[model samples]
Target: MRWGVLGASAAISRRVMPAIAAGGPTTLAAVAGRPQSAARTTEVAAAYGARAHHDYGALLADPAIEAVYIALPNSEHVGWTLRALDAGKHVLVEKPMALSEADAVRVQEAADAARRTVMEAFMYRFHPQQRRAADLLASGEIGDLRVVRASFAFLMGAAPGDIRLAPGLGGGATWDVGCYAVDAAMLHFGRAPRAVRAVLSRRPGADVDTSGTVLLDFGEGRSAVLDHSMDYGPRSWMELQGTHGSITIRNAWAGADEDGTLTVLGYAGTREESVPAADHYRLQVLALTDAARAGTPAPIPLSDSLRTVRVLEAVFASAADDGAAVPVAEEGTG
Candidate 1:
């Protein structure tokens, strides 16, 4: 598959693109950006051996580009995803697929009608380390699942006008990083959350959250706590506790830099596993190719997205109600 890029944020340009370049059955074909960003994208494309264009339409209209990676701001995900599907190009959009669930569904419906792929890029799930964790959890080494706790945060010491603080841009820790925690918890539990409660910190003039903590209950007496922030030190980790022992994975969410540790303790014994660095984007691209060519399922399916969006919506409702607990229902799909 020949791929094009829709704008290059620091994260996308430096981290994701390199992984895409190394992925199987996929090649970087072109890059599109704002008119003013054309020059930078051009230089990047040249360095990566891809074409470059000034507007989104030009890239979408490019015949050589069979797929496009939407690395634009969060708010642009829905619009561009729908447009890319309509233009006959597969899309792998950055996560928190859209600002709202309705928009996410619209993207999915467009993809279904076109028979094209519209995927949410949650890179951690593609990493081998994540798969290892999943295997360990499924083996019941941690015994019957009970609770999951995860956190992702980093200093946003951003420039005065950085979009991470712009609500209009769909910028916030909840949409930015909390999605990962939520995804992990939901997938690990293999069910949608039953209730959600959250506290979002916001300041005047800032339309997005600076930081927040959310709680998810999956019933069966199981629950999870998720913490996210845009104005804090770097932290990414998770833990799962069961009836017998516990499994702790330090830096669980930061799969790209798998310089983390995994600990499993039980009546049998205790083991510490050192996870080496892995290219999550390469894994993601490979999975996408598998789904497209072999008719394999997406690593993160549309229904999983629906439940996640539902959880996020409930979180918003809870936050809007000043942290009132909100109930979440089971979804028809994972």
Candidate 2:
């Protein structure tokens, strides 16, 4: 698959681009950024042996590019995804595919019309550690899954006017990091939450949330708690508790840096299993390319993206309503 990039975000220049260069069945054909950042975009593109465009449309217009990876701001995801599909290109959009369930549905509709692959880029899901964890839970190693607790937090130390601090850009701890926690819970449980409640800590002069905790009620005596913060020091982990045992993952989100371990504490005895360090970003690109070439279903389907945003919508609504419980909107619900 020949790929083009739609932005010069940190995730793209620092991670995705490198991954695309190192892994294949895919190639970085071209890249584009905001017109004002043409120089930086050119530098990045040149580093990966790709052509650079002054604007996103030009990259999409490149007939050689069969797919586009969008690392644009969260608020821009749906719009760009629609455009990419309309351009006859498959898309691997950055996570939180849309800010609302309604918009996610819109993206799904566009993709259906285009008959193109549109997947949310949740690279962590492709990690060996994540796959191994899912296997263990499915094999009843952890027994009946009961609860999930996950946290992803880090100090921003961002300069003034960083896009992450901009409300109009969909900047917030939830949209940025909390999405990973929520995703982990859903991945383990294999379903969406029935209801959600949250308490958010807002930035003093910004409209975006800086920190928050969200609770997902899955019923059947199952639930999940997710925590995220942009102002806190780095701390990330996930724990799944069940009837007969529990599974714990440290450094759950980015297992790319080093070998990751999953600890199982069950009825018989405690054991720790190791998964070798691997570039999940590279693995994700490979998956996308393979699916696209084979005309197979996307690894991260639109339905899953819509489900996650529905839960997120409920989380934000509950937080805005002073921590009142909010029912996750069913399809077509207002």
Candidate 3:
């Protein structure tokens, strides 16, 4: 898969671009950045032997590029994805594919019409530990799954200019980090929650949330508790509790090499499962490329992306209403 990157963002430089450079069925063909960042973009592209474009449209116009990796800001995800699809290119877009379920639906419709593959870039899902954890839950190693608790928090510098602190750019701790926790819960439960409630904390004079705690009701006495923050010290972990036992994963989101662990505590005794070090970003790239070549649905389908946005919308609504319980919108509903 010949790939073009839509931005010269830190994520692109630090993770995805390196993954693309790593030997696989994928290659870095080009990179595009705004005029102000042209030099940096050129440097990044040259590091991997790919072309660089000052304009996103120019990169899209490059016929040699078969796919696009959108590492743009959260607010730009939907528009670029739609544009990439119209350009006859498959897209692997950064998470929070759309701020709303409605926008996600539009991207889904566009991708289907274009007959191109589109995937939300949730790299952690491709990690072996995530799959192993899921398998353990499915094999009844954790008995009947009852509850999920996830937390992803990290302190951000008090830089007022950071994109993460800008409301108009879809900036917020919830959108940036809480989405991971929500996705983890949904992945394990395999269904959308019926309702959600959340309490948010915001810095004075800032419109975006700095921290939040959300509750997802999955019915049948099952639920998920999620918390995220940009004001707290670094913490990332998820725990799944069941009738008989529980599974805990450390470094659930940041899958650095050999830095993750999955511990299972069941009826028999406590045991730690060894999850080998692996580059999930490269795994994601390979998976999407293979699926695109085979004309199969993306590994992270648009429907799943839509469901996650729906849940996020509900979370925001509940937070705005002072933590009132907000019901998640069903598919095809406004």
Report lDDT (CA) for all predictions.
0.83, 0.87, 0.90
* Best prediction by TM-score: 3
Question: Predictions ranked by TM-score, top down?
Answer: 3, 2, 1
Worst 10 residues of 3 by lDDT: 251-260
Report the Cα lDDT for candidate 3: 0.90
Distance from true position, residue 193, model 1, in Å? 0.8
lDDT of 3 by residue, 1-334 (tens): 8999999987678888988878668889899999999899999888889999999999999999999999888999999999999999999999889998889999999999999999998899998989989999999977899999999999987796888998899999988999999999998999899999999999777779999999999999999999999999698999999999999997788664755688999879998887888889999998889999999988888888999999999998998899999998676675
Q: For residue 133, what is the lDDT in candidate 1?
A: 84
Give the TM-score comparing model 2 with the true structure, all chains together: 0.96
> Would you list the clashing residue pairs of candidate 2?
none
TM-score of each: 0.95, 0.96, 0.98
Candidate 3: residue 100 Cα off by (Å): 0.8
Q: Write the per-residue lDDT of candidate 1 for residues 128-178, one digit (tens) a residue.
A: 667878888889878898999888898876568777777788887888888
lDDT of 2: 0.87
Q: Per-prediction count of colliding residue pairs?
A: 1, 0, 0
